[model samples]
Target: KPNSELKLQIFIDTSSLEIFINDGEAVFTERFYFDNAPQVWLTAKAQCLTQVYRLDGQAITFE
Candidate 1:
């Protein structure tokens, strides 16, 4: 499949999280509860660049 440029916004609530991508062009909404707070993980390939950000304003670059 061809890769498309995407923008994702993740909203974290007490009981669920909502992910909106490309202004609702694509969406993955679900409810998840873990004993420990979960971390966000992103993976991409084929000339992909990934940038990760934490709620605390920390950012990391990934390949």
Candidate 2:
């Protein structure tokens, strides 16, 4: 069986995030900041997974 998985690794020091799909096939880098945001959240729908992290946090990992 071929299962698809999305992994999001957030690096707080650089204020950036690295997204990997199915290990290493697809990758995306994004940078964001929220002055008044709550805890991180992971949401998944259909065949996609997304991770939301706060800027104050040290790091975040999603699998």
Candidate 3:
């Protein structure tokens, strides 16, 4: 991305992931299931800022 900031969002729920880039300009959907992957890595060619968040699903119990 040149002359513009790049934005990305990742949502992980039940062994599935939905990724968004540049507010839906580009997106990637993937499903991965492994009890142990040991090492996970990311490579970025461009200089950027990254953030990670863990999602909580239906934390509140309903009666």
Candidate 2 per-residue lDDT, tens place, 1-63, comes to: 245555656444344556566566777777856465324555655566555544554558789
Clashes (N, CA, C under 3 Å) per candidate: 0, 0, 0
Q: Which residue ranges in model 1 land beyond 4 Å of their true spot?
A: 46-63
Name the 10 consecutive residues with the lowest summed lDDT in model 3: 33-42
| lDDT: the better of candidates 1 and 2 | 1
Q: Mind sharing the TM-score for model 1? A: 0.57
In order, the Cα lDDT scores of the candidates are 0.72, 0.56, 0.71
Return the TM-score for each candidate structure: 0.57, 0.37, 0.55
Once fitted onto the true fold, the runs of candidate 2 whose alpha carbons sit more than 4 angstroms away are 1-14, 36-38, 44-63
Per-residue lDDT tens digits for candidate 3, residues 1-63, read 456776878776667777789789999998876576323355667687767665466778789
Top model number, TM-score: 1
Candidate 1 per-residue lDDT over residues 11-32, each given as its tens digit: 7655578898889988888887
lDDT of 1: 0.72
Off by over 4 Å in 3: 36-51, 59-63
